[model samples]
Target: MKPENAIEVRDLKKSFKVYFDKGNSLKEKAIHKKRNRYEIREVLKGISFEVKKGEAIGLIGHNGCGKSTTLKLLTKIIYPDSGSIDMCGRVSSLIELGAGFHPDMSGRENIYTNAAIFGLSKKEIDERLDDIIRFSELEEYIDNPVRTYSSGMYMRLAFSVAINVNAEILLIDEILAVGDVNFQEKCFDKLKDIKRAGTTIVIVSHSLDQVERICDRSYWIDEGEIRAEGDPISVHEAYLTAMNQSMQERLEKEDAEVMEQHKKLGQARLMPVFCSDIAERKGTFDVEFSDIKALNSIGEKKRTFHSGEAVRLRFAYKNPNHVPQANIKFSLYRDDGILVYENNYEFATGKVLDLKDEGEVNVEFPTFGYAKGTYLLNAVMYPPGGGEVFDEINNVFKITVFSEERAMGVYLLENHWEEA
Candidate 1:
């Protein structure tokens, strides 16, 4: 059988040459050649992978681990030191906040410029302009320079133009992290529609649930290499297990070192007492455990949910400092890190959370709007009168979406359908 692929890569390598001074002349170039050589920042490390047509794949790894570097090479934003990105069909990328736009231009003008760069004709941009503006929900601000727009607004317009390009293959990074709830939902619905049109997608996200939900498969990258690929669940599980193990190992080593230092110094850094217990979803089950580390709580909470079910989460914890009026938020992701839902509990309007008490606060949201498959839930706690977020909870839970007997519309509709 011939090698199967939609995107082909072999022995990919990329490096950046760091120049200390920009004004160096030819004489300096010669002198540097004879004396000090330019420093190299090796980004991609001889990695390789292939993506089949109509397949959705997720890429995940630590920060600065060449995930974005590979995307840049694929999109031709930067040339690789070695290797090739062999792609067939019309391709488009929503990499790095979705679009390249000038801040001084109006939304309309920037859309025109960006669309043309994506290989669309002026007439094509004109045809899509209305659709773009409507989707971005920036009709009033369309005439304003993008420099005046908020980060969320800027991202909205950029994404609006990106999805309308009608490319055969689309590349997306983590742009959904900034938009509000309503806009994010709209964009996600559009993504589902785009996938149905047979456009291949490659998403690089920290949202494991989004990857597991939409991706036909996934690619796990580690240390600039493809560590795992195939089914999203299997690959995701493997990665999580590995990460947990690594965290455990590090904690153990640190504990031993700290104890040894304390013996010699008479007293050492005071290790914070851990609540220790945490909730985590193991494949399909919800897990709770305590006292594994004796110090800081060392695990995450995870669960799976189906559609139309009452999605309820109770957060329980202990913090010494009293939080007077904190801005607490919950974020949902369809794994691979595409942010699905996010909201903060500010003491504004009708928001209230008595985190000072020992009782758990149960957060309930109807889940009928979500499609079938597993989803991830993230919870964040901020101190009262927040200047900076002190702590974070990562991938706390997983929720599954069901749509068999429960199926009605694309997602479960809250309204009752009466026969006409």
Candidate 2:
């Protein structure tokens, strides 16, 4: 236990004994012991990590991957079957919002009670009560019974108490996503302040963006073990790669019959990559592609298409202020970044589309005559004349074109074979 190390966990392991066919009736209960089928499920297997003072660490993994269990062990909410955790500072947990609150107590009373449990004295809690209430934004409801508070209200109060308790180590478990966007931003700002003030924080979250935003270092836990640990960006990228493969395998196993049929039809899998940095929205109005899909000749949404087949690029954009006229541009690029086709809405159709405040847009291509290769989509929106880009997507949506029925070049043109 070094002076500057807030937490150091060593060889941590936890497991549960799960039993099936435990009888409900008394007679069956008597024989249940002999008939019971039990298995040991290892939830955390020899995981070890450390958090230094003033350092923010993120734990990211799939659901049921022992992330919450590790937090519990760190907070002493649950004991590990083996291994040890060393801590040098008072800890505060935002694991379960209002977990220690007496439901009948008023929000104001719960604040004091919770803070006190976090080792705050009466004087300390009193000094911090006003700030907690102010940050929660529940001034009027602070006196109301906590049972009557909405989930959001309850979480706000809980987070307020946890953050204000002045604990040196904060264990946050995905609770910062409680409120709306404004409040979430506020919470992140507060976390930044806390980090600057030298509070060691451990956050477990599914949002990679949140992890990358707040964490200096991150650990990726998988199947009760530390799969990867390093800087947030690299850890997150590795985790995503693993998760993507896992999802593909699961999907294939679950829907083998359907996938086989598609395969037999020469259809390729569609993989979409979302690039958040490329989307540029300057003004109040915004344009971003949502639910972009490719439909086959039969109007079924698919990821792959055969040459000379009808493929429609169906997508929707958000325009809260209903910008009446915006030039829509979509470009098709080869997998290796060579531009294959580019077109503008007005240039291709000779007129602009009637803008809706929020609606779907369907662009149908009569025949997809591309070569047998993968193509990526980049959709852009510009204010009518086209100098300023309102929004642009760089090679995100993907479509695979198979050449079973058409030529091997970029264009799938129609021609007649005649004796000349």
Candidate 3:
């Protein structure tokens, strides 16, 4: 390891044996020996990186991408199959929080045991005991058996002990989600303080925003290899782009298979490419929606849009009965099921839609005035006066809005400030 580096990893590799049809009992194992076949699944493939003292680096990737495995290797919870890892100081890890905790033991007692596992001396633990208890906000329950503690309480106790260890190096793995939102914020603030105090930190997390805020650099691992490593923001942007492209390809393949199935059944079903699986369909089917799409100003299919960007919805319907007139309703909802906006074609234009055997209707929002978040969409067709329902699809499409400005609430209000 270089003198200036707090930690160094060189060509680290690890793999696990994934068994197939393995038996647990001795008798069953003996009788089905041949069924105990397994495969060597390589998780980390010759990955290498270094961190300077006081520097924080984040490992990011989709699940099963070996980032967690790498953390385990650094903490020595698991051994690497090959290569080397060198560290400079005592390490404290939030990975597998409460791993050494005894459920039957009192929370206060478990704190001493957990801190001891981090190589803290009895005197050192005694010095920090009160601080840990205070941070956990569980002083009242500190003497209670951990078995009686809620999951959040247990996590709080464990996190409190680990964070107060003041080790030279901290390894965290998705444990920042512990406790309620307020506690989570407090934990973040504590981490920032730790970083400022010059503790080398390594984090494995799916929350890219957290990584961007705390880490000096990021490594994007994929398929057992480090695909990209650099500034967190740039690395994450590349990672997201690749992931979205892969998802699009997978969705297209699945849509093709569904189309083939529909053809064989001699039925025209909504294309999976346009309709979400969670969409709910109802009504008499007098006029069924054939396809629906969220589009951009250029009429190109799009599900994600920036705040204040033009958004359009195109609805295609099949009216076998040639219903003369119908009212068209469109609704938008936030992810939390809050209705954000609702309108109808008849109400807006003062005329019901004239139906044909097959036709398309388009609704355009010159500027999509919404905050950054996901929203669901609903489309409905009914009689002019809303006596009978023709067709209604709830959550037929999902729209995602992004904004550069940081503000609160569902709608993005347009405003300007003048100094007085």
Q: Write the per-residue lDDT of candidate 3 for residues 139-232, one digit (tens) a residue.
A: 8999999999999999999999999999999999998999999999999999999999999999999988999989999999998899999999
lDDT of 1 at 352: 59
Q: Which of 1 and 2 is ahead in lDDT?
A: 2
**Candidate 2 residue-wise lDDT, 381-418, digit = tens:** 77876566666666644676655332346776777788
Q: Between the candidate structures 1 and 2, which one is better when assessed by TM-score?
A: 2
- Residue 397 miss distance in model 1 (angstroms): 25
CA-RMSD of model 3: 3.6
Ten residues in sequence with the least summed lDDT for candidate 2: 271-280
Q: Where is model 1 poorest over a 10-residue stretch in terms of lDDT?
A: 283-292
In candidate 2, how many Å is residue 210 off? Answer: 0.9
When sorted by TM-score, best at the front, the candidate numbers are 3, 2, 1
| Tens digit of per-residue lDDT, candidate 1, span 284-387 | 10111111121111223223333555555555545444444444566777755667667676633366555452334445564435765545555556654555
At residue 275, give the lDDT of candidate 1: 20
* Model 2 lDDT on a 0 to 1 scale: 0.80
